[model samples]
Target: MTVLALGLNHGSAPLDLRGRFAVPLDALGERVQGLRQHLARAQPEVAILSTCNRTEVYVGLPALGASACPRHAMELAEPAIEWLAAQGGTAPAELRHHSYLRAGADAARHAFRVAAGLDSMVLGEPQILGQMKAAVREADSAGALGTTLHQMFQRSFAVAKEVRSRTEIGSHAVSLAAAAVRLAQQLFDDLPRRRVLFVGAGDMIDLVATHFAAQKPLQMTVANRSTERGRLLAERLGAAQLPLAELGQVLGQFDIVISCTASSLPLIGLGAVERALKARKRHPMLMLDLAVPRDIEPEVARLPDVYLYTVDDLAQQVQANGERRQAAVAHAEAIVSAGVKSFSQWLDQRASVPLILALQRQTETWRQAELAKARRALARGRDVDAVMDTLATALTRKLMHGALSELHGSAGEAHQQWADSLQRLFLRDTA
Candidate 1:
């Protein structure tokens, strides 16, 4: 078994398809537990990183024997893929079509890149690191984190920090929140004159609302399922707050609406928008739905007076500005490459632990036997020098017994192989 990363991102899967697999952040722990039970035989260490842009499952399976090295990675990852598909209630084949799998060193490289935001929709966007940290916390809380995955993420965070500090990758980073504001600007010339309503007090809404606030919109209000949560964000932005129930009643009051919630269902329906549009006397409204499993219905985009943009639509706008940061991409990739190499070396060392332990145990047993014999000889009135010399001779013989036996038994190519191995193991120069 090996480390494997299996999932589909915005680039690999469409928005609608991605939403089907987008596990809510609050429910991540539960989903992880379910997957753990499903793969109990493998006893895999699992972490699910689910965000607006991607849903990835990282698993560190129990170590395999040298003979099992020939087994394919997908054979080990199939259980995870099936469990994930079952969670989404999606067809396994459909998930497989859009998903990509990374194994061993490749999985480590992918994790590092993802944490560094090199794999995000918006190049060098910093939010992914925080999202990754949140995923780690959730997985750890669910009792799914183990040595392999814990080390991988801790190293990933370090790499991300190095990439951000050592390079200017984030210098021109255009985040989805910033992209939403840019798209809204395109539809509405006077952002300062438009009243904005943010339908959610979650992280994404907080981000997008902050971007809109920078423009000093005419008025801003946060409408959330919980008035208390909405009020907190509203106070930060110096805006008003309203419970989510009043959204339809006051929806028309705001000219620009942004919604991102973990509702698992559309918060803004066609009828709600149609009613709001009619109340505005057909005045156009700019609505940005940054939520996966969408906060705004797809059908709402049909209304002539409303412009609806989802996360995918915003990603296109974000990508157009990605070329400006191209110069820094190479610098970030170099850091990630070094990180992957280091992690691979660490993994190799961990694999050698069993052999190392066995060798140490065997040598200790031989030493104990030689020491006992020397003590017995001394008790029998043997000369101290003779006993010491005899102990040294016996220990040397015992230490070289296996190598000598192998050399004596082998012939031709096999003899040469054993000879070379012994020379490297025992005859190598050490100062």
Candidate 2:
């Protein structure tokens, strides 16, 4: 089956479109199962990798001839788009402009680069690799991963590691949390006086909390679904913990709310933010939603006192660090290219497995027939040693027969090329 990848990401789509395409982490397994069932009717294998930065579908299908694989993929995408739109309160048409579709080697390379964080808003950020790995693991557990998709993801991870180790792609990296801190600095002159409420105990939340804590916010609290994980992170930062249940009532207590959670639905909607704003007497509140499916509702952005930012909005704020990482880009790109070539070669070789098996079967059949004839000769009271020698000679001659016939039949350039190749493959020379 040929491998193909399709999807949209931060670079190809705006926040609205990305929000429309985001898949909830909780529903990912069911989504993958649905995709598998849908694609299995025609396409044999499929895997999905969805993150805050991108939503990609990788499929393994029969040869492109008269196949509806692309159409099937679009059909599969429709439900995902509809689901995302319902979550974001947007229409599919409105989100289409922001979507991108990639196929073949380009798709493979894109996956690798994404895992390496080259395509991230904050270039060379490391979180995306882990996120992608988690997605792959989920897909595998859901039985969405087949040979082609499995190989692609495995090689993509390898490429990411190679790029990270061989180049400075991840060196001097500015994470999304760090970028959020920079943005908050632009809004507030002094973070020390500001109350920061982190709504989630995930890694992103932890990292952002650490950055905000370094600034020594006047007060900090971690509100999470599980108070235990929240308290763990809160204690590390000398912050307090609150149940997510208290978020609506206590939202007004913080000047900043940075949330990153695996919640499938929005935790902070427009009404909650509006109430919080009113409670705060219209004080400006900086809100960052780093979750893929989104922790904050898009409508919350319309609130006068709520300055909301999604993952895409932060991309513009992350500078390329162009000159400092220019040398690293070439080195990283070379590593990715080599990785892609090697992966492609392996994929091509994999496609020839059936033919290789057929050839092996054919050779074994001939060997077995010759062995039977040798056994009969020995049974007829012929010398055992002679029978063994005859069997060995017959196998060798049978193995070379096709090559000798081809060499004799070949003409001109073909004959010379075959002779040269044969010499290189088998000949030994003495001084």
Candidate 3:
């Protein structure tokens, strides 16, 4: 089977389109299993990496033959695309229009780039690496991962570590959390005087809350559906914990709000923000929605007193820093290039495995037949030297029979080709 990467990322699709394809982290294993079932005819081996900026499906499709080229494997991408489109409830044509497909070496290069953070919306961001590792774990647990995919991802991780250690790609990296803090600073005079509310206790929220906490915000609170999870994060930052049910009742107390959660629907609605504005006497608020489907409603952007920004907005804000590190990016790309070359070489070697096994089996059979003849001769009390000579002759003819037959049967150019191939295979000193 040939390895393929099929999906869309922030670079290829808009946020709304990406959000439609986002699979919840908690259900990743189940989704991976579903994909395997969908492509069972191809006996697919699969792994999926879904993040805020991308949702990619990496798979291995059954080959038409041992020599099947990547282009042929690419023709099988329709099934995977159909399965992925089904996930978002979109038509196949629409998903295909926005998605990309990479086969063979190109697919390997893409995997390496993603693991190294070169493909992230936030260049050199470290979060994607962790997320990729999580995807690998989920795929393995779902029984969808196989040798081809496992090798690709394991190599991807090693290459990512090499890129991180050898280059300054991650130096002074501007993460989404940092960008949110920077944007909030532009809106408020002093963070220390602004009340902050974090809507969820997920990893994104924990990171953002830590950044905002470092700014020493006046009062910080974490609102989550799970009291234990929310309280743990709150305690870590020396903040108060509030039940998510009370979020609407106390929304007006915070001047700066940053929210990220797994909710399918908007957590902060227009009416809720309208009430918060009235309660605060129309005090301006800065809200950043880091969630995919969006924790804050789109209508909140229409409110004149609120500054609402989504992941797409943060993507633009982080581009300046990414552009400034072109040198490091170039260095990292070199690492990825070398890694892709090595992985392709490994794949080529693996392709010869079947022929190598067959050759071994044939030679072993001949050896056993000769040994049986030699043993029978010895049992008849024949001379040892004569038996050894006969055994050696039998093995030699058996080994050369195929080549000699080809040399005698072919003519003209075919004869020369067989002679040259045999020389390379059997004549140690042929030049």
In terms of lDDT, which candidate is strongest? 3
Q: How well does model 2 score by local distance difference test?
A: 0.78
- Score residue 55 of candidate 1 by CA lDDT: 94
The digit string of per-residue lDDT tens for model 2 on 167-265 reads: 888885778788899899989988999999998898888888888888888999999998789889989999988989989999988999999887767
Q: Total backbone clashes of model 3? A: 0
| Total backbone collisions for each predicted model | 0, 0, 0
The order of the candidates by TM-score, greatest first, is: 1, 3, 2
| Selected candidate, larger lDDT, 2 vs 3 | 3
**Which pairs of residues collide in model 3?**
none
TM-score of 2: 0.81
Q: State the lDDT at 294 in candidate 3.
A: 75
Model 3, 1-431: lDDT tens digits are 56889999888888878888888888899999999999888899999988888999999775532234656765788888899999998999999899998888888999999999899888888999999999999999999999888988999999999998999887746789999999998888698999999999999999999999999999999999989999999999999999999999999999988898888788999999999999999999999999887789898999999999998899799886544488888999999999998888777677778889999999999999999999999999999999999999999999999899999999999999998998898885856
Where does candidate 1 stray beyond 4 Å?
Answer: 64-70, 322-324, 408-417
TM-score of each: 0.94, 0.81, 0.94
> How much lDDT does each candidate structure score?
0.88, 0.78, 0.89
Model 1 per-residue lDDT tens digits across residues 157-254? 99999999988877778888888888888888899999999999999999998999999999999999878898999999999988888888999999
